[model samples]
Target: MAASTKNVSVGTVETRGIEPVPDSERHGHAGQMFWTWFAANISILGLPLGATLVAFRGLNIWQAALVAIVGSFGSFALVGALSLAGKKGGAPALTLSRAVFGQRGNAGPTLVTWLSRVGWETITTTTAAYALLALLGVAFDVRQNSFLTVLCLLVFIACTLLISGLGHATIMWINKWATVLFGVLNLIVMGFLVATVDWSKVLEAPAGPSSGVIAGIGFIAAGTGIGWANAGADYARYLPRTIPGRRLVTASAFGAGIPLVLLISLGSLLTAGDPSLATSSDPVSAINAMLPSWMAIPYLIAAFGGLLMSNHLSTYSAGLTMITLGLRVPRAWAVVIDIVLMFLGGIYFMLIADDFYGPFSTFLTLLAVPISAWIGVIAVDMLRGRDYDPDALMDTSRTSRYWYTGGFRLPAVLAWVAAIVSGLLFTTAGTGADDVWFSGPLADTWPGVNGLGWAVSIGVGAAVYAVFGGRGPITTPASSPALEESVR
Candidate 1:
């Protein structure tokens, strides 16, 4: 039965869920990380992020490019580091997080992570649907009515559900091959777009203040790699323990970093010429308008394919997270539930929402705080040489090693909550002062004004956990020969 369950292969549904992957099933090299991350990030979403830096943050093209490089590369490096926990423990990230946050206590971060994944999946789905709509419009002269809109969304969601429901092996396979196919198509389209850029206007744009650059970095990081930080281990959990931690980190960073920098720089340049792209409601159609008539079809195709790649990965992680949150269903069923929600979200965004960038930017800003806090706690635990006891991770009762103090790890929970509060105190999310959703008391402070709330959250979470985490009885690895020998 164990062997049958471990039979994960390309084109087959991966049966594993939040459970730790047994040693016998572990197979892969660090290099795969590059393709996984690269495929996830090749979507045109990064373009608007760059545009926002120039349009809203008042950054020049050069400054926006610099922010992209630093923010994307640095954040994914942290993702790679967190992935080490997955490799060591041989479990999904939140599953391994049980060791750090305790069984019941883990629910808070797990819930937040699940919500983040769902939010991103919905955004990706909506964006891809728009791409498909644009493609149909350009290719066959189909107009986007309500019926066509729903149809496009269903098509994208169905594709995501199929890939994500197949789980890990299938996602990895598609990541490699689809990345190659779409990467070439996107580059061709990008070449055409680049040729059309207004160079004089791009060069004449004045540089913004240093403060804008700082905010741009924060926005880029939050939008790009920070969103994926928690899900790093969901993909990496299948790798063998022998892989060096640094190698994994390097692969993830560069895999995601390479395309992001180029796309962001292009976005900045394009926005420098026409700032309207930054505030466009439908980025897919907006970008398509700039492409030559001949290139529009392929450009939209690339956009659709790229967003599909990203959505599937996010959906896959969201499924695992849902299971981790105690959802009583098979992994595939959880994916189905998530897809249903995503479908609804797509409908709302396409039919009801007044604006796209406003809600998206606010979502990123608000969610970045709790996610960063979780990262801080997990990073500290990983650095402390924590090893997950697989059996204990599954055992949710008082007998479990992870059931720290009435099923709550107070230190970690306290740290996470405190960090979230502190971070929110600095977070101000809205289009402007009049339209603010919620602004913290410290919203006028430099960190608040500059959008460094996520950074502040991480620091506070780590600092608080470091001080109080040792107060309780320290968890030790279960004394099992299989586990012992594996570590050695």
Candidate 2:
């Protein structure tokens, strides 16, 4: 068998082993790329779906709107800020870790990101299965069970394999079209609500001030934006610096954050009529009841399309992260492996995730600290005014800063460890009917809101890394590679 020859670069750093894609090989220009990002990132429909079901049942439209607005704006600002930090710190994310944890240190965060992909893949598969079950229930009055779950799993795995097998370019192409279809469906639902809904009902206040409204907002924001945070660079890495990547910060932010809130709001309004249905686990069920039977077919098709789009993205990002970790596998092969794992993991969840809310919530809680730490370090690196030479950032050569100290960076390592510990505390703290440790009013009601885990993780990780990790000098190259520096 012939060896695959695709070059593997670490983060954005430049080096010899890696080769830049020819213009023909590159995906598209900036506008095209932006839309691709918009579509790819929006696959997070499950995030808002989960949030609406679990967090704010009685919230009036005003409150729902407010929550959506805050969540969207916060995510946009944070993701943009973190991306800017990565730009400043010279691939401060996946690559910069080399300076702290060693070349092997990169493995720690990569593993975290990879695990996050798996979590998302699992969650998405479950949600897709759940949504299909809801449709079945609506049609035939059948109940959800492990059998339906397994059937959905088979469908999801099949779709993932089919789409991903076509390659990255094919995925990008599908994303553009899916986004258009999704946009039309979004317009349809919102249009219906505006046309039919009683504004007075939507404007009324909820039953009472929800216990974890603020904290609930936090978890919702985290779930919605976490995937974007981990893979922001997957798109940005290809951005031409002349285009001013900062604007991308804004575009990327609004592209994702605004639409998410609107979707949640739409779900809220659509479910407002049947108060009991508002809290239903399946988002489709909650909203589908609002529309006429004629609308169901198109809406279901759109919803299923949206589900597949997002699921494909999770698998795609998982493939990229796996490759970054030096998996030495073709992307096609990596995606296949990812689909297999997602199918198997999803089956496990179907049988024993216990409560939909419980395991899903626990999964996010476990992830909160480490992911926060990773984002925090990158943000701090930007704040410190670290210089990012694009060529150097993508280089895989041994002489670059990434390869200095035998490919390990201590500051990144320490920061990661601290973040993990903080996350553990935040997840495990507090008990039922008692303040565990640092349990606040929010934690008393909302299971996931107790410890302010996200804040602690970001603050501690950033503070520790900024104060201690900033002193290292950029290593200069010695043995010269006889080639012109390739630009992205």
Best by lDDT: 1
* lDDT tens digits by residue: candidate 2, 291-333: 6876765666666667777777677767767766776666667
> What local lDDT does model 2 show for residue 324?
63
Cα error of candidate 2 at position 388, Å = 6.8
lDDT of 1 by residue, 330-358 (tens): 78899999999999999999999998988
> Best-fitting candidate, measured by TM-score?
1
Q: Scored by CA lDDT, what does every candidate get?
A: 0.89, 0.59
Q: Against the hidden reference, what TM-scores do the models get?
A: 0.97, 0.78
What lDDT does model 2 reach?
0.59
RMSD of 2: 6.0
Model 1 TM-score (2 dp): 0.97
Score residue 340 of candidate 1 by CA lDDT: 97
